[model samples]
Target: MNKYTIRKMRKSEVEIALNWAAKEGWNPGLNDAQIFYDADPEGFFVGEYEGEIVAVGSAVCYDENYAFCGLYIVAPEHRGKGFGLALTKARLAYCEDRNIGIDGVLENVEVYQSVGYKPYYMNHRFTVLAKRNRAKNPFVREFKESDLQEVLSYDRQCFPAARQHFLRSWIYQENARVLLYFERDLLLGYAVRRKCVEGYKVGPLFADNEEIAKEIFLAIQDDIEGQKIILDVPGNNLPAMNLVKDFAMEEIFATMRMYQRDLPAISHEKIFAITTFELG
Candidate 1:
């Protein structure tokens, strides 16, 4: 009989893991497979038992100093067999010597902590039905090729690491919309809304302040009125919490942003919404 083994997943195998993520109710973006694969082709991994895949995880190393771990899952029948633990260890080893981040579910918080991951803050997922908004700000416009550098520059201010490749594909993905808040030569913020398994999700809603964030949020939903909208708010940002409460968005899920080392220094208030819990 073949023994269990761990190996790096191929690009096509990434989608198979994403399918399992969808079945687990993660609501990943429809175009996430390619974008994720492009982020770090060598980041995704899988565990096979007796020649059959049974577990998966990711340890995307954005740069030498920073990495994110996520998309961890084990087939229901394979739980408690140590396959998941082996996969986790493999991912950790792949990301060693870097500050690793993960949005771990609350139930697994302690489990992660025991492995040297420290909880930094809570991220709450909120959902609401889109509504028509007559407000239109001339400063807000659809992303264009000319705006790539400016967007990346501003995005770096909000995100912890530089992920130009990931951001490039994320903005141009099919069935998605990327909007920017610019005033004259100043690129204040930007947002991306993508179709998910159920409805739509607005993320990486980085802004200079709460007002700009609100405008971009409502603007993204203007055309998708009445459709389900989801946003993951960081608990550390009071304005982000207030923004969701102002819309009466229902809280559906939550996770702890944990790290294996020192957390990267970033503009906490400017990160209105995280890009993705899976890849941080």
Candidate 2:
């Protein structure tokens, strides 16, 4: 029998986990390591066997009531062993009874369900070549430091819990651009575009309505024109589905959004895109 050591991962070791994710064709953002580490330095965990790290996972507690689990990966040569399960247990234990969420692939849905996770909905990842839209909305503007409070307030309507620290790191990370739509001093929505391993990804695209969502989405693509753009949207949001179809984006991937408890009651309609599978 092989003994596996499971424990919290150091900040610097996060890159190793992300590299494994990229090798699995997950297309992680280039600066994800720093941003994710900043989200919760104590949330990431690793499993080692005979002094060699072989698996990784994360269970980020956004608040006392909510946590998210993801980035679960085992080295290709280390799969089929119990290392992955050990890492998963370690992360779950760290979450400590909080309502934990995860975006998992379909093939593992049953595996997750067996461990007390229930599928809530599907999140589809769509991709398209960015094309500049000449329509410019005056209300859409670059995000400023002063807008952080209002942005975080608006974010809570779509997300499950307060993630001020994570949002701060996500918006200001290198190779990322944050944009917000404001009208009459009211924060309507915001969006983030970041460079990924392959191209770029726009996420956490929140808006009061489809028009506002479209505005932020198109505006964020201004500088990244001609690059591949990715968006992960909830299956239940019909408006979000229509918005992506209007852009002629192709569905490239999908994940089952599962939770260990009841789903959080938030404004799902406002969420045009989720942050990321590995972090949400």
Candidate 3:
């Protein structure tokens, strides 16, 4: 048997890592690894044995208080061995603090729990109305540099800290559409959507009311071209919950956002959707 070694994932290896994620049925967004690495290049990693990569994952230490670890995958042929656990433990060690979080599949919760990981909370991904037949909202537009201060101010009210690096990388270009909601010259909310594995996903959906949230959804629907759309909504937010129901989106899967620490204090009142179970 060849000895296995763990190392930082190269930019070229992102495809391999993503393929592993796909086999796990994670349904990652398109260019996701790019966006993520662009945010923090050192976070992603992989395990290689001989000439083949046997396992992969990431430890995105956005900062001291909130670090996230996910994208864990091991080849099916190597499942029974200790490769998975070893790779995971190595990834965990990369995190600087105890605030490590992850959105684990139900099947492997116990496996993760065995090694210091714990249950945090459950999350859901819903399929919303397709925009093939009707026009989407006109308010939604591409993100621009001018919107920086506005987005920063908007993000502060929602998340605990200013994830400027993550936000900037995710909203890198005009393609990563960041929609804003306005009424009488006031910035009430914002939403972000991008292409991923299955189709388009709008995450971190933030809005002051159901109406604004609904409007942002409509705007995204217009661009999807009948493709499937996915969004993970927090179980506690009823307004955002009802808004998805209003649009006739179907709940496809329920996932638990597991964490070694308590869930951070986020503004559920204005948050209609979270960016992703893995990152946030």
Candidate 2 per-residue C-alpha lDDT over 1-280 given as tens digits, one digit per residue, 9 for 90 to 100: 1578888899989999999999988999999988888888899998989898989998888999999999999888988887777788778888999999999999989988988899989999999998887978999999999999999999999999989989988988887899999999999999999999999999989999999999999899978789999999999899999999999999999999999999899999999999999888
| Model 1 misplaced regions, further than 4 Å | none
CA-RMSD of model 1: 1.3
Over 1-280, each residue of candidate 3 has an lDDT whose tens digit, in order, gives: 3488888999988888887777777788777877777666888888888868888888888777778887778888977788778888887888866588787877888988897777866678898556852645555555668987888788877765678988887776335678887666677778888777778788888888888888887876675667888888877788888888877889887876777877677676888888876677
TM-score of 3: 0.89
Lowest-lDDT window of 10 residues in candidate 3? 133-142
Candidate 1 colliding pairs: none
- Which stretches of candidate 2 lie above 4 Å from their native place? none
Measured against the true structure, the TM-scores of the candidates, in listed sequence, are 0.97, 0.97, 0.89
**C-alpha lDDT (0 to 100) for residue 18 of candidate 2:** 94
Which wins on lDDT, candidate 2 or candidate 3? 2
Against the reference, the lDDT scores of all candidates come to 0.91, 0.91, 0.78
- In TM-score terms, candidate 2 sits at 0.97
Candidate 3 or 1, higher lDDT: 1
